[model samples]
Target: MVKGKIAIRRITSPKSRQVTFFKRRTGLLKKAKELSILCDAEIGVIIFSCTGKLYEYASTSINSVIERYNKTKRDNQQHHVTAAEIQFLKKETESTMQQLRCLQKYNRQLMGEELSKLSFEDLKNLENVLEMGLKNVRSRKDQTFMEEMRELKRKADDVEQENVELRKKLRVLSQDHREIKGEFAAETSSSKEMSKSSDQAMPDKDDIPERIHLQLSLQPKAPSLDAHETEIK
Candidate 1:
């Protein structure tokens, strides 16, 4: 006759539970050994009776099997951690990429390259922002321009002062030059007049001798005695 299937539930009686645990423990250890031999696998089994008796089996040393199991569990946990970190990085990268795309779109909109989606209110706000930015830029530019103009004016004033000083120096030099030239002319004229006076005061060689001869010839000739008696008769 065929037997009915066992329900496999916990036995109510302590004695029956203990018996079932022993039988199952033995069968489990035997199956583990057989499986290891058949599949060339490392296998381990462990059980505890209701009375707290320990039972165990291993294809290799129990300590070695336990160590291998612990090592494998640790490797699996490390792998899971690594995979989770990779997934998180991928998610962060995707989020960053999305933010980058948003920024690019916003930049294009700000540059007026993508205006189709902007509402009237948005356009008004953008216009106001642009106008404000323009005003600020113009204000800065004007301030810089004024500063440059002031600098240029200061430099021009400095140059003008230098020119005035140079003119004064030139005027003084010119006056000095004029005074030197006048002194030289006066000296030259005085030397020429002295030369003329010296030439006039010296007597000529022909004048002195001719004057002596003229004086001698002009003396009255003594009258002859015969001419005088003829005149008287």
Candidate 2:
């Protein structure tokens, strides 16, 4: 007879461990077969070795056993979802979501404000965007003003040059006026003397056309420099 209790410890020696494993494995398989045949028990046993080799036994055909188990589970009102049922549920969910979107859109149209769903945070974000746009507009306006100011300053410089030329022309006209006055005085005296000596009178003053010129002070023309021009030493 076997001892009252065999010490349940690992068989340390390699050969001894292997022998124990083989004996236990055979005994377990035998007991399983006996239970299946004598007691009509539906049994499935899976055994693995330390090296990961597999051994399996089923009292009936594995497929039939699996099918019978599934049927029994269903009869007991198990809530497990089969692969097909899971796929069908996924499709149904997608369809429901699509319909929900259409209904939500229609409801929003009836309500006349689709943006009412936005929360405070969403409004704040929108406000920030609008503020940024306003800031950008102001910045662009300032930049445009600066550019226009620069152009106006350039035009003012040109006007100043034109004014200087006009001043020069005015000076020339003043000098000419003085010369004309002096010539008239000399002619009057000389003509009085000639009348006193002869009957011929000084010629009557005729209308003389004076030509006025508009002088524009232009910047000196810069010499054109060709891109290919180079000094070779």
Candidate 3:
């Protein structure tokens, strides 16, 4: 009897699923090995079980096969560029170069260079453009100069105000210093006067005999002998 082909579906039984997985994994690896040996070609197979187990077979080193595959993919991509695409790229390049040249020429003209090829009308238009640009530049320059001047003036005013405040502070300090000096001088003078009075009121003990001698010397002397005789006559 001819058996019917089994339908492809998920196996619900755990035991049957595990047994099927083991058998398929072993068969797949065996087929890969046989194919590699018979064909003498590189082969690689990777499988993952429902339990997240990894199984792989490689006739050559896996790394070498992956590198060769990536290199071939890159080569195929490079070879896939058509003539139309090349032509389109060339056109784009030429357009970009042409625009660059035009910009360079325009810059030279603006700089008053390469004017020999310009017509009279073109030169007139260029002259107008240059004049307008110069006028704008001068106007901006004047505006910037005025702004800077205003800023500088403001700064100078601030500095002047600061100087005024500082001068006021200095003046106040000077006045305070003068007042302190005057008070100190007055105190010093008072101290000196008090000291002098104390000295006069309380004379030194050693100076008492000298003061007494001075007073005796200053007293009126007794009349001389001649003066006394004249008085008697």
Q: For each candidate, what is the lDDT?
A: 0.91, 0.81, 0.94
Write one digit per residue (lDDT tens) for candidate 1, span 19-55.
8777877788889999999999998787776677788
Point out the higher-scoring one by lDDT: 1 or 2. Answer: 1
Clash totals for all candidate models: 0, 0, 0
Residues forming the 10-long window of minimal summed lDDT in candidate 2: 207-216
Clash-forming residue pairs, model 3: none
Against the hidden reference, what TM-scores do the models get?
0.46, 0.36, 0.57
Q: Which stretches of candidate 1 lie over 4 Å from their true place?
A: 1-100, 201-233
Query: Mind giving the per-residue lDDT tens digits that candidate 2 earns over 1-233?
Result: 87697689977788988888889999998999999999999987878888788877789876677788889988867776688999999999999999999888855644445768877886677667768978999999999999999999999999999999999999999999999999999999999988877644433334122211222224365655663365322
Ranking by lDDT: 3, 1, 2
Candidate 2 ranges with C-alpha deviation above 4 Å = 1-114, 199-233
Q: Is candidate 2 or candidate 3 better by TM-score?
A: 3
Highest-scoring model, lDDT: 3
Q: TM-score for model 1?
A: 0.46
Lowest summed-lDDT stretch of 10 residues in model 3? 60-69
